[model samples]
Target: MRLLVAFTCLLAGCLAQKPQPCASPALLTGTFTVVTQNEKLEIYCKYEYDALGQRMRLQQQGTYQTKPFIQDFLLLFREGAMYQIFDTNRTCIKSALKDKFHPMEIPKDATLLGQAVLGSSSAPGQGLLVNTWTGDMSDKTGKYLSVVTEFGCIPVSTSYQTNDYGWEVIHFFNNVVGILDPSQLNPPDFCKDTVMKTDEEPLNFLSLFHNLP
Candidate 1:
């Protein structure tokens, strides 16, 4: 009877210590591209994020107005600040961004679209599930479908577009990883300071007005 009790206790302890399946909170450092043929725009983005996703550095290199250009976007979530450095104008834009670290999980109210087997076969269980969701009552235009991978990452997402004719964006991430230097997240001193309201930011409104021209 004592041996049996000991065995049961051992089993219980082992079960409690078993590791649970948790997705990586951050993406691997790599480059992704955003190509819009109708707009004649191709943006090459290289991104890096801290393990906790509290800080990120994004570099966009591409061509605009038939000339090559590059820009850097920095997010310091801990400080509630965002900075943008533009190579074309040698300017830096700083603004407050009210963002906080939230654990990644599919929304409880999201509508399940379908299951998808994304990523290479070599990376086992890199599959994702698709879901459609609408934003809070204040924002009706935020309706979209998002693909959530087993790693808790959204590799693809789309805003509302009827019959697929309006507009769409797709991203493909290169499988790469490396240690990021802290200096990469800082904007250069030469960048003249510029500040603007979040809603009035040009990048924030690019999608809304780009089709006009």
Candidate 2:
């Protein structure tokens, strides 16, 4: 049969050699559970990177509910990390960064997910941030973007600027969502004076909350 179909296409091209990533320095922590229509979220992250990879610490913890509204947060990411934080409750909307829910400025179309390993997402609200994509909504406190694998794993797509809707960074989890791109995330410049985050902008853990009180 044509030499058994050319030896089954030469044994599937020598078993397709294309699965090689993860060398050393591994710490793309886990623990996630997300379900979105509006809310029902839980995330636990602990990322560590250095040796010239950037993204030293992106320790995030989130809790969300939408029965009567239960929101708990603690976010701190340095050097522009795509945001979309809300909870106006009509108090002049706190720090005010709204438009369609604002905080956009993390795209130079420089994929490799440099800062924290989040990239191209969807399945969060069924369509994922594409209302016309005007800015950023990559998730730091939104409730979607379960974990998009930027450093590596080849599952890219979280660049939806937003205009009307439909970019995608919703939510999904069962397992194996472990990616640590941005060239393996290496953050250690004493993490910019131990977790910056201050007066107006610039923040990143503050030396793990000043050694926790």
Candidate 3:
């Protein structure tokens, strides 16, 4: 059923948080474009942090048209592990969550859905949407916004709908912080013979790891 409620909310967002505190360098770099729809999809993300906001490299890249078209993907969560590099599914998935933190779990009946001022102009902040979850968008629920800075919240956006299907991002931006070249932090090399996908099976693909929550 909807992939078993999206794998039980990705195992309850990796067993709910525990490893936070590390993510400001202006919340690690920027670049945005969310535009979601059946396929007007935009998503041209970017990130590369390290002094603890952790995320050592993440490059989403997109610009869709329809019928499953995609051309960019890269992620690397380092240390406590996580890596996903789907050059259109050539494959490279891995996972590890030790002392877990920041994977997912904003839905305690999420609701707000309003606020303002996002990023870019000298890093604007104070955005909000508090939460939302219109339910069953294939279990992704939907809508979550968070920007309030002083180096805190930061999430940005999300959306989903079901019936035929839908997705949304609308817009997002972090601005540009730093740290990203240990040769772009591994993963290429034709995805290094693809193996990595862990969770010790029994059902843990998590669709090639979508950066925790």
Candidate 4:
């Protein structure tokens, strides 16, 4: 009876442990919606991500501080440049891209909150199993909570709060495994006339809009 009880305890301990961290596919295409606290900024974007090549592209439309704008961004991590195209004005600005590629993955040190089914799980394969995790930002200035599919590690949503940005929630959807067109990562021909602003402050995705007039 003691041996049987010991075996049962061991099995329970194993089941209680959290799963290892997982990463989404290296190459993917997806759409995401971003909404900030106070409804001051909202953005809808279609993106192509190439982690292997260290490049990304985004075509986004958004209202920032109550002003609507359409823009396209090509981030070339290897070249350390970002081309921000103003779609309405047919102008582009080439600025230094100071950020590196950050994969969409649960950090190894993240704390697992729990797991839940996204839909009804009364029948087999009826619902997606997802896990929630919370962790401090890389800079340790903010906190984030994320939900991702259990099996595929696909990101479903994330909420981030920082001293500077306040609260922002991003919902990711329609993500697929690969980039359809390689050229989508390249700067458009109209960007040939891009004004170089490398001498100005370097920009990351979040900081890109602050410089916009």
Candidate 5:
């Protein structure tokens, strides 16, 4: 009877175990698809992120307002600048980088919602373990939920909503641990003559999309 009780306790403990918080690699490349809650916008992007250098670059192609658009963005947090490049028109807009660099990781205060397997666990070596976490945005105006791989802490998906912006969902995939080309983070040559617009409010990712022509 004692042995049976001990076995049951061990099983229960295993079932209640939680995953530890983990941060993604400092440098990585990935592709993501973004969809807005209103369904008015959908974008597919290939991105390169350098957390250590506080920089990011994105090649974006999307349909907005029933029109197709292509844009490239270079965000340099250290220099406090953001470049929006239109490849088709050879034009660029420079604005201040208002948002701070936020690494891809589970927030320290995030609450773990649950864990699951992405694939069938019945088959050996066929399942990918993942965890979901939720938290309020740092600004307290929004909330976010994210899913990440259990082993490497790679982002799988994230959804966030604010009172002003509604909601946006981003699905990440095909991520690798290192940047293939560091030069990708540099501003395009067309942006060399672009002057920073000091009259307009600084732009974040969502605002950039909403204001797209």
Candidate 6:
């Protein structure tokens, strides 16, 4: 069955690296949805584990769509994101490794770029892709150094019994040398000043909290 195969991959991904595999036996299964004031989307998933119950891969197919017509998408074992063009059914777009990072907070914003990045909706069949690549690139910088992360779909934590699934990003900046701008780091348009960057004490120099590969 398709569900069985998909779950097997998710299980391998989580358990394959553990010392005593198979100790944790059950798989992680759940549904994920994201609702913006303007749009709604959802994904239903099932996963399988290795002997140690490690997750190996993830398979996600779009279960619902709105405001935008999306063709189906597949999460390859360990690869990239691809979507077909709304205009040309035969045409498909593939993102380079960098574009794969999205839904991320831009920690600093003080800049003047010659471009604009509407939410990922501006493009169809694609996830939330944020762009600050003006190419004009100001003479600015900040910490976290504009990290780039690519995670297919993983639930880091949960609340209210809702299995929060899908990719996540703490911060991301593209093509910046070393500085993070203030305006560029403004809260996401959706958050509207509610979400604040972590200005905590005793920073974890060991990257215990960072999402790095």
Strongest candidate by lDDT: 5
- Model 2 root-mean-square deviation: 16.8
Could you tell me every candidate's TM-score relative to the true structure? 0.54, 0.24, 0.25, 0.85, 0.85, 0.21
lDDT of 4 at 136: 95
Q: Compared with the true structure, what per-residue lDDT tens digits does model 5 show for residues 90-150?
A: 8898998888788989988999998999998999899988999999987788899999998
Worst 10 residues of 6 by lDDT: 204-213
The C-alpha stretches of model 4 lying farther than 4 A from their native spots are 1-17, 86-91, 192-195, 209-213
Q: Kindly give the number of clashing pairs for every candidate.
A: 0, 39, 8, 0, 0, 35
Per-residue C-alpha lDDT of model 6 across residues 94-115, encoded as one tens digit per residue: 3222122222223244221222
Error of 5 at 166 (Å): 3.3
RMSD of each: 7.3, 16.8, 19.7, 4.2, 4.1, 22.8
lDDT-better candidate, 4 vs 6: 4
Ranking by lDDT: 5, 4, 1, 3, 2, 6
**Local distance difference test, each candidate:** 0.53, 0.31, 0.46, 0.85, 0.87, 0.26
Give candidate 5's TM-score.
0.85
* C-alpha lDDT (0 to 100) for residue 183 of candidate 5: 84
Measured with C-alpha atoms, the lDDT of residue 16 in candidate 6 is: 45
lDDT of 6 at 145: 18
Candidate 6 lDDT at 160 equals 17
Tens digits of per-residue lDDT for model 4, 41-157: 788999999989989898888997789977788999888899877767767889998888788899999998989998889999789889999999888878999999988898899
Which tens-of-lDDT digit does each residue in 90-192 have in candidate 2? 1111121111212212233222222231334454533322111122344532222222332333222223222222232323233232354543243223222
Clashing pairs in 3: 22-52, 22-53, 23-53, 29-176, 29-177, 30-175, 30-176, 103-213
lDDT of 4 at 210: 42
Off by over 4 Å in 2: 7-9, 14-18, 22-31, 34-84, 91-201, 205-213
TM-score of 6: 0.21
